[model samples]
Target: MDVLNPEQFRALGYRAIDMIAQQLADLADGPTRRPVPLDVRHSLEDQPIPETGADPFDLLDRVQNEVLAYPMGNPSPRFFAWVNSTPTPIGILGDLFAAAMSPSAAGGDQAATYVERAALTWVKDMLGFPQEAQGLFVSGGSKANLTCLAVMRHVMSEGKVRADGMASIDAPMIVYTSAHGHSCIEKAISALGIGSKNLRIIPVDSQHRMDVEKLREAIAADRAAGLHPVCVAASAGTTNTGAIDQLDVIADLCEAENMWFHIDGAYGGFGILAEQTEGMYKGMNRADSIAVDPHKWLYIPVECGCAIVRHAEAMRATFSLVPAYLQEDRAEPWFSEYGLQQTRGFRALKVWLSIQHYGLDGYRKMITQDINTAYELRRKLFARSDYEVVTAGPLSVTCFRYVPAGVPEEQLDDLQRQIVAWTNASARAFITTTMIDGKTVVRACHVNFRTTSADLDVLLDTLTEAGQLVLQGAQQA
Candidate 1:
């Protein structure tokens, strides 16, 4: 009888629709994309989960009052923290549609198979990977990177690495990555029993890009010292500074060295969607395997990271397991054989629907705007005297520090940290902190699709005001 109450469900549905619509319409004015409640810690509870579920309507009411009213607005035009998502209205609508129609992406039915494969194909094409390459969508970059390294290790070791562990190897297989590469690789080493000690940290250039010369020397030295150079993991865009490595040079090195080349293009690889950055990623097509996170740039909801390997055979070799029930005598796109997915989500729908609704041109425009806004922010900071850029402008992220003219580095670091603290505390907008060459500094990334140059300016002004307040506090003390 309760399930038969369509009228009641309709009323709830209408309420939900209205609330979401209102939230989306007025998202920009509420918070500038950064929600920092100074009093949150004081009020937060350290309790376990409740024993039972509360009334659905009552829970909805609490959500509306607490969450809806508070500004966790990721879509706000001023969120410039860590890499963020800015899903379009169409994408949001598509999310609703996906929820309504939950297609299991385990490759059984013809319809789900066709659509998800089509979306995966589109992703591979965007990255300029081989047509024969196959992939599976995972939750995010960490998982994607894990899948990639797992596949690489599997192929390089010819199944020995997974079966018998690194101890079974004749020589130490060295994994090379720039110092700036994400820690996920390190985590992969620890988890995969490859030994994080075997993961070689190559140095970077002044621009923070992976130094190809240093890499070559390190590989040569390792080989001379009786180690096998198994693979090179290059960062397409670093998380801290959006620093892209010299992919062309690194690609050449990989070819010469005959090692597996994996590009962790989690941040910048997909910028091929942008006209300016398109050529910068020219060498990505040569990668044996690559990782990209849709959650960061594609503005898809969280848990959407993709991995593409040039040869479908490699992925098949990496994650394929042969059990009686799951064994396939002949080849089909039985997805369980590729990567570490048994029952993966129908993530393709969100990506496919987002691209279909926005089109390539719209996505490009948003990416271009975000890049330009980052440059614009750099210009604004350069114009001011109180702040100084620690590095050159970013294609997507900018790092700067607040220091009065001629201040010593020690005092500058403390003041800059204080400035950042005050600015985030104010909660008008949110930037972040990073260390550049051992000095603490503020790091801003312009990945949010909704953020405009105007939002960047407002953030700049708010930071400046906050800096002045910090100076006043210092004086009072």
Candidate 2:
């Protein structure tokens, strides 16, 4: 029997939509407020599975009251914690429609397959990448990095790694990346059986960009040691400081070395849209592969990333394994042939809808606004003698610390962390801390289109209040 009649389903759906709309309207107020009481939270934790069927409406009520009422504060304009972006309204609706359609994006001449192709084309066009490049919408940056690096492994092995496994390679394949590179690169190396030890962590200069001279030295040293240099994974924008590596220089090195060049642009690739980053991403289009996250910059809902490879056939050969039962005679290659996942979700719908909702020019303006606001925070921090600017934008991330005159040198790092905790607990705004050059500092990333200078002010105010309380408590202790 049907769980609910069509008319009943329509009514329930409307109710659910209304609930979501209301939540969105109220999202800005107390964006980080802890709504649930401690007792109620304990009760929720102690919940037991129901032994019997419950009314659908009752379940919906629980979802609205218990779950939706509490949020992670990512939607708030003042949420300057990580790289998370507030989801666009159009993207949100696209997610709902995609789920309803429920098409496995594995390939075949289907609607979702075409939508995904078009979406990937849009991504390439938007990023100034070649339209001929092959791409796949993945879960997030982690999978995107893994997929591209896998192709690098296979290609560097001359396709023998796929058939004969890692044992086929005689020399140890070495991968080089900056110490500030995302941890996912090392994880991908380890996962591909390349061994993390073979991954060289090149040091960065004062600006946090990968030092080109040091990289060249490392490659030469590896060659002298009889290790095979496979690839160099450079960061378009590092997560901790938004520092972009010297891409054009790195590209030149990779070309001279005859190595695969991969750019991890997952967090700040889209920063290219900002006018201030005019020449920052130079030679990025020449990379053998690039990983990017539309969810971070395009305001798409979570779980959307793209891996674009210059050589489509090479990527296909790395993951294309058509079983006898799954074989299909289609002119267009299936998405399953592109990466690790066979049964992929229709992640492109939300991304496609979001890109269309805001054209490239629109995205550029919004992204520029975010970068400007981040710089504003940096300027404010610089104006105060007590606050020291650790790492400030060339993009939309700023890391700084409050160092009041008499604060103990040893306790500075601990004080910075305590300020974050106090401010977050107050629910006025949400921020985080990160280590830079062995010192803990407050970090903020501006990716939300809804965020403005006002939100930045709120963040500073909250931090100031939190800092005072932390210092007072420290003195008492």
Candidate 3:
């Protein structure tokens, strides 16, 4: 086997960097999303596996021309459809360095392991978690949620389930979360052998925050019915409306009931950095565990999430399973003993580098900007007679619909769908739609630091034009 000489490697690396920088500079020249043409797709699919190695520079050029030409537009400032952030340029460079190193961060006496541990520590501090808390980076929100729930199950079962499995428990355990909570929670429950039927869907108040009184009543009813209530999953920032549940009240209830309190802060956990939104997460420190995504709000590259647990020993107990061949005589704790993956990638490098590049103060400014943008968009929507605000916000999400007066209620949903299609087709901006309180409404989330007030104006203007066109088409029919 042969490797490129240092001189050749440096040349290729510099070219790749230049190519990416040029693309970033020209991002505004293209649409947020461009579907690959059928011919291009077919050509890509029909390519046969090569028996001989090709020139590395040629392969890189082909990838740049064919693959990078089309993207989902998550990095674009105009992309407000979902809770995706525009990756910071520094973070992108950190990703390249991590890939070059290719360290298996599962655990060992290696520099990568220490780097990951330090990154996780910074995350704990950033989120106001106790210094004694332990955490590990995982793939993303879904896996982060799963890792937290697994520990909750292990501790709640008194460590019996670790060896005997779910069959060891005689009674079914119950989990509680709001109706607007992410579906990933239910999926975690099902995967953990806890029936989805056992997961109680609690109601939310007018602002979409979880109703604490209802939650208490549900817990009482479950206790009366002889079902073991194990945990309560609270949402720091819900996906639909960016609703932050009443964390303080819920934390009190969890303490009184002796139930595990888990906070799903995948998209909103970093909101704590913004002074204006800090109060919303007042009791988050009391949570037994929190699942947060660095990729979403931290402006890091994708496939990075953190799962922090209050009790470090409990996490180790739940996940540690040292095989004979894998045994090491090191005093330092291995990260593999704290999470699900045994062969983890160097995800922490990007996080560590990004945080260092933009200190806490810088992050606070960016997050505050996003929150202010959300409020600004809501104010604009309220000013319009054709738009109806489904949810009001200080958070980084606003849900509304384009409803001209006298439009039949039955036609509103279809009109909203048409407006979204028109926006996507026009390529002026990207926004999504969701059902809020049984009414279809357009949802815009401001997580990209690059997004601006002008983008929001464009979004509103485009939505207005789309709505008018949709109504005209309906009348012509």
Candidate 4:
């Protein structure tokens, strides 16, 4: 087999970089979301497995033209349907370098392992975690939540879980979370053999924060029924309306009840970097563990999520099973002992590089800008009689619906759904819709730093036009 020479490699790499740079530079000219051409998929599927190696430059060109051209549109500034961030240029470069190095960050006294530790430590400091707190990066928020819940199960079970499975427990271990909490918590519980039935979905207050009184009542009722209340999972920023559960009150309740406290801060955890939103995250440091995603708010490349635990030893105790062949006499910590994966990639490089390039102060500015923009959008929407502000503030998320005066309550839900479908299909801008307090509403999350006040204005204008068209069609019919 023949490999590309150094000159050929450099030439191909330069072309790839140029293509990416051009794409980023002209982002506004492209549609926020577009369907991939059917021929593109057919071209790949219709081809047989190559018996001989193809020209490296030709393969690279195909990837640049076919694969990189069409994406889910998270990189576009106008893409606001989900909690997605536009990747920073420095972060992209870091990812490229990491891919070239191809280092397995699992363990064993290597630079990649050390880099991961340092990046996690930086994250802890950024989130105001205790000095002794330990963390590891995982695939994303789902796996991060799973990792923390696994540790919580071990610690709450008093280490018996490691020796014996869930059957060893006397009472049924139950976990509690608000209705606004991410579905990952329930998934993690079910995957751990805790059963979804053991998970309690507490109610939320008018502001969408977890109802402290209801939570207290539920815990008491559970204990009275002879059930074991093990953990309380709180949300720093819910995906639906960006409501933050009363963290301080939840922490107090957990302290009194001796239940493990975990915060799923996947989408909005990095909001703590902004000064305006810092107070909202009070008592978050009191959490026993936190799951946060750098890909959402930190503007890093995808597939970077972090799990931090107050008790590092507990995490190791929960996941440290090494065969004799993989044993080593190293004094440094082995990352594989802290999480589920035995083989890991260089996930730290992009995170560390992004942080270094854009310092904490820089990130704070971007986060504050996004938060301010969301609030401004809310204020503007509230001024309109047709728009009802369902939830706003506390974070960079706003949920509202366009309600014209004479529209019947029964027809409002369908009208809102039609508006969303029209706006998405038009592709001027993309915003998602969700149910809030039994009413359908449009939801916008300002996670991308590139999104500006002007963009928000354009979004509102486009939405208004779409809403009018839907209403007019409904009236005509």
Candidate 5:
């Protein structure tokens, strides 16, 4: 017998829908638990680790009361700690439908074909890539980058790669990335059996963007030693600073060096949807491959990412392994031939539904609002003498540090740590600490669609208050 009867399933669905709707509609008043409550979190492990099944009603109730009530934090209006991990109505419903439908998208002619094709085309075009671009739905940015780079390795070796292994290549092929680039590049290189030594970490300019000259020089030196610079990764937006690398400059360099250019636009690719910053991603069309997170920017739930290739042939060359069962007679083979997925989810459904429900105009307005709020925070941050902004932000992410006059830049860590700790403990807002230029600094990324000026104000106010308390305690001691 089914553990969840028809009636029980209906009730469970309604209950979950209501809980999510209420959370979104009343997000302004929602208490984002910044510092996770250790005591009330006892029920988190109340369930049996490997229970075969459970009563649907009881499970739903427990989830509503225990899990939802005390989540560490969700990206909503009150959340500004990390980049937007917000949820959209259409996307949530689309995820539900996807689970219910269970359409396997691994080039199956019967399941998830049209929607996946549309989603792939949309992403390809949206990033100035060609409509013929092919890719696969992956876990997220890191996985997406790994998959693309793996293909880069395979292609650079000219399809003799997996057959002959890394030793097949004559010279030591190096993959170069900027110091400010996403850490995923390094991880990808390591995962692909390309030693970390092959993954060169190039330096960045003052703005944290990758230095083109350094890249050229590095490639030249590698060439002098007969080292093949097979691939170069450019960042659309870095995770720590949200700074976009100069794609145009890097693209030119890659062309001159005859290297495969991959752009990691997991965070900043969505900016292409916004009108004002649309041109910033101009040179992405020339890239051999690009990775972007539909989950992060499209406001879908987690674990949806794509890696699009400029030429569908390149993708096929990278990953087409004809399985006896999946083999179909075709000149080019199926979409499954590209990248590292055999049976993929209907991940495209959530993103496609969200985009259709809210047109480009709606997304543009939302992005504009987010950008405006960031600038507002910048103004407020600079108003006080104790605070200083590290740089003018190009996107919603603002990197600033709590700096007190006459204090050594090195000691700012102690004070910044206290401020972040207090703000998180207060349950008003949350942020993360990062070391910028060898000095500890605070990072506030504004990506939530529901966030407003008032929430950001609470974060700033709480920061100053925390600083004051720390200073007072220091005086007393």
Candidate 6:
């Protein structure tokens, strides 16, 4: 049966739009509200599934009150918990239009396919990748990394992996990444049939950049032991500390060793647009494949990531599966031939519309502002005697610890974690913690486009208040 008549559908749609607009307008004060109570959440969870459809307007009311009342806090300007960003308004609209169109983006010469190609071309242009390179839009960093590494496995196998699998390779296929690299690399390796034991964890330097000397030594040792070095997955920006590995140096080593060079630039690749990171991402364009997430820094909505590869045919060799019913005589290649997905969503429209709304220069200015904000955060922490800037690098993340003068070193880790809890509970600011160099530290990632220096001030003031309260309890204990 039909869900609703045209008039009723329009009414419901308008109401939903109005609700979303109101929420967007109120996001500036989102962090002030405490999270939804557990009882409220459990009540929603305990509801039985309805066999019959309910009234659409009633459901909309429940959604507006129950769901929209509680947000994940990322859209709030005071949120510095992780790499999540506030989506652009234009991008949100694009998502709505895309959903309305509802085109299957897997294959064929459809309008959705062309739009994806155009968006991918813009992504390549932004990253300085060659126009001739092949790319695709994936879910996010994890899938982007997996798609690229799957191609790496195929190419490194010399056309044997697709037919015979990992068993065709004689020597163990080894991959290398820094200790500070994203954990997705190891998971990708394991999922690709390369054992985790074959993944070498190279050491990092004082700045948390990958140690080139240690990497070279590891490669040499692997060669000496008759193992094949397939690829080196370098981090453009690590998660915990935002440290950028030496891309140019690692590129040179990969060239000398004839290994596939993959870059997990999902978190901070867009940092290349900022002048502060001018020389950091020098050789990124030279990578065999690179994974980047527009959702993180480009301010696009969630589930928009790009996988770029210099060798298009290698990717086709890895995942091109065509059935007789889906075959068509078209000049353009289908997106399904490039990666693991067969029923891909139209994720490219949001990226395209967002980038169009904010041109490259506009993006550059925003990213530079974010970096400057991060610097201001460090400057404030540096000026204070109670907090120590622990391991923030040259990006938009700052890892710091609350260390009162007389507090014991053993108690500092727990104290920092407690401060995070207290600050979050205060409903004034939201921050997170991470382990850096075996010490617990508060991690603040500035990917929110709405955040400003004033927000940083609020964050510090709330953190200071939280630290005092937590410190009093620790002292008494």
Which runs in model 1 stand beyond 4 Å of their true positions? 1-6, 32-53, 70-73, 326-331
Candidate 3, residue 424: lDDT:
77
Model 4: worst 10 consecutive residues (lDDT sum): 27-36
Which of 4 and 5 is the better model by TM-score?
A: 4
Expressed as tens digits, the lDDT of each residue in 1-477 for candidate 6 is 976888998999899899989988888766544678888798679889889989999999889877877777777888888788888989999899889888879867787888888898888888889988899999999999999999999999987989998899999999999999898999999999999999999989999999999999999999999999989999999988889999998999999999999999999999999889857889999999999999998988898888898999999888998889777744778898998888888998888888888899989988888888899899999998898998767889999988888888998888888888888888778899999889999999988778877888888988888889887776698
The deviation in Å at residue 417 for candidate 5 is: 1.6
Looking at candidate 6, what is the lDDT of residue 109? 73
Model 3: how far is 175 from its true place, Å? 0.1
Compose the digit string of candidate 4's lDDT tens values, residues 6-82: 89889988988988998898777677776677898787578888998888778877887777777778887788887
What is the lDDT of every predicted structure here?
0.78, 0.89, 0.89, 0.87, 0.79, 0.89
How far in Å is the alpha carbon of 94 misplaced in model 1?
3.1
Lowest lDDT 10-residue stretch of candidate 6: 26-35
Show where candidate 4 strays beyond 4 Å: 44-47
How far out, in Å, is residue 107 in model 1? 1.5
Residue-wise lDDT of candidate 3 within 332-371, one digit each (tens)? 7789999878888889999889889889888999999999
User: lDDT for model 3, on a 0 to 1 scale?
Assistant: 0.89
TM-score of each: 0.93, 0.97, 0.97, 0.96, 0.95, 0.98
Q: Between the candidate structures 1 and 5, which one is better when assessed by lDDT?
A: 5
Off by over 4 Å in 6: none
RMSD of each: 2.6, 1.5, 1.4, 1.6, 2.1, 1.3
Native RMSD of candidate 4 (Å)? 1.6
What root-mean-square deviation over C-alphas does model 1 reach? 2.6
How does candidate 1 score on lDDT?
A: 0.78
On a 0 to 100 scale, what is the lDDT of residue 306 in model 2? Answer: 92
In model 1, the clashing pairs are: none
Q: Write the per-residue lDDT of candidate 1 for residues 1-477, one digit (tens) a residue.
A: 235277777787787888888877776766643453545433334336788666667756765765676655466777777787666666666667767677656666545566778878888877777778887788889888898888888888877877787778888888999888899989987787777898999988998998888899999999999998989999888988888888878888988988999999888877778765776787888889899987777788776898888878878877777577755433565676786777666777788888777777877887777777777888899998887887753468889987776566667777777776666666667777878888888888877877766777778888778777877787799
Clashing pairs in 4: none
Q: Model 5 misses residue 414 by how many Å?
A: 1.6
